[model samples]
Target: MGERRGRRGREGSAVGLEKYWASDPMDVLRVRQDFVLADVDTGSAPGFEGKKREAEKSLAVGAGILAGLQEQLFAGHQMGDDPRRILLVLQAMDTAGKGGIVKHVMSAVDPQGVQLATFKKPTEEELAHDFLWRIRKEVPEPGMIGVFDRSHYEDVLIGRVRELAPPEEIERRYDAINEFEAELAASGTTIIKVMLHISMDEQRSRLLKRLERRDKHWKFNPGDIDERMLAPKYREAYQVVFDRTTTPYAPWYVVPADHKWYARLAVQHLLIDALEGMKLDWPLADYDIEEQKARLATG
Candidate 1:
């Protein structure tokens, strides 16, 4: 069940979803295919409640394995002479469970080796600099895993959605992003961008449930309602962005997030697959074993 091999159980499990599972890849795909689709109220009863429990257990087990593999990367495993750097970026609409995904997916990684940056609205300082400045500060160092909870993509997603920048400016920024990502890839960073796709109904249900549960009420933001109102606009913006920006060097995975469990599993599997190919070997120094043994014998 180590992270490298944990995904074997669910490589195609999504393709085999049963009707009672409450969520299916095909259903989520349909929602995306028809962007004009209305957001229904799935909160009355979680469509996949029965199947959710089993999925959760599977995800927990998979996450445990992934953590261990991440440890191997930290331990200085190398594929040939090249050490690897992994930068994972998770993007999603409101309440698509970005935080939850980070918590569960990266739970096992060593804290020092993993840095998580969650980007919200730009600050005065961040805005003062180029869009990539704040992001540049968060890139993973060699032999580390960096997780950007939101990331530079916002300059494309939200900026375009709100018309914060002009058309020419937006076109220029996409080229900037492509170059930035290409540079990261060329420098040995494995850049994986994930876009978590959640249905409007699912989001609405989550928002309401957050309101009903006092303990979770803190997560309820009135602004989210406004964002929900802008859902179609955002989807249009995302579709355009996806088409222009999904690169071979840094591909985008549109994760079906209506089922949080499935979403988490898909990401974990993808990450594990990327890392397994790395085949890291522990880094060794020049010390001779015989000399070390002699020193030990002297002691």
Candidate 2:
């Protein structure tokens, strides 16, 4: 595909190629924009050891940014005038590091104000209601951050990919998702959706590592293999979702997950951009410290 603005056009370029070179590096590194840089083909690194090392380095940098953002958020809550809520909806196949991100990226944030919800297969009760009913209950309250480990997008992404629903049903969902997200945006919830993209080979290797290691055995689910087998179909489903749903109100970010650290960094920067854009003001208090000090002296 032809390149526009130094990055891949609409159709994403290879894994690491997009946005490698930018006039101002940060200009290419935007939170809500599409990228089209050359791919960095870091072929299998000597028995996967090199890949692990690279992944760790990227993850560390991302974690650092996350920690810094946590601090900023804490201070903002205490000393700043930001009242907008930030929500992160992480959607990916199993073993895509959703939990790891919660553990590492969010470890520093105050738990009292951060909510995380993990959605799995619908229960008999959940299926009984509209698809979004469960998700609606989990929306973050004011003065809090809500994290959806998996969210309403499943109605479209996984549902269509697995052929769990008919084509007409899938088509109907596109508008529903838009209106749902639009309502959230209109209501003041700043929604950020992240799709973690990992290569098929990387996923297989990660699954194998989980099976071979005793500590990781708990993550070994037979269903994971079945989902991995459907990557191509999932990719197609995502293409449709992305094309239909990437709107000004609620944009979707497709993050490269092979490098965990890089993903974290991108997410951190994106969060910062979103929060900073809010132009938050500190809440006003009735009493004035300077006036109170004067009154005390007079008394």
Candidate 2 local lDDT, 191-224, one digit each (tens): 8887766787778888999999999999899999
Expressed as tens digits, the lDDT of each residue in 19-65 for candidate 1 is 23444332342223324323433222233444567767656665666
Candidate 2 overall lDDT versus native: 0.66
User: What TM-score does each of the candidates earn?
Assistant: 0.81, 0.75
Candidate 2 regions with alpha-carbon error over 4 angstroms = 1-83, 288-299
User: Worst ten-residue run, lDDT, model 1?
Assistant: 37-46
- Per-residue error at 169 for model 2, in Å? 1.7
Superposition TM-score, candidate 2 onto the true structure: 0.75
Give the deviation of candidate 1 from the true structure as CA RMSD: 5.4
lDDT of 1: 0.73
Candidates' C-alpha lDDT = 0.73, 0.66
**What's the CA RMSD for each of the models?**
5.4, 8.5
Q: Provide the lDDT at 84 for model 2.
A: 58
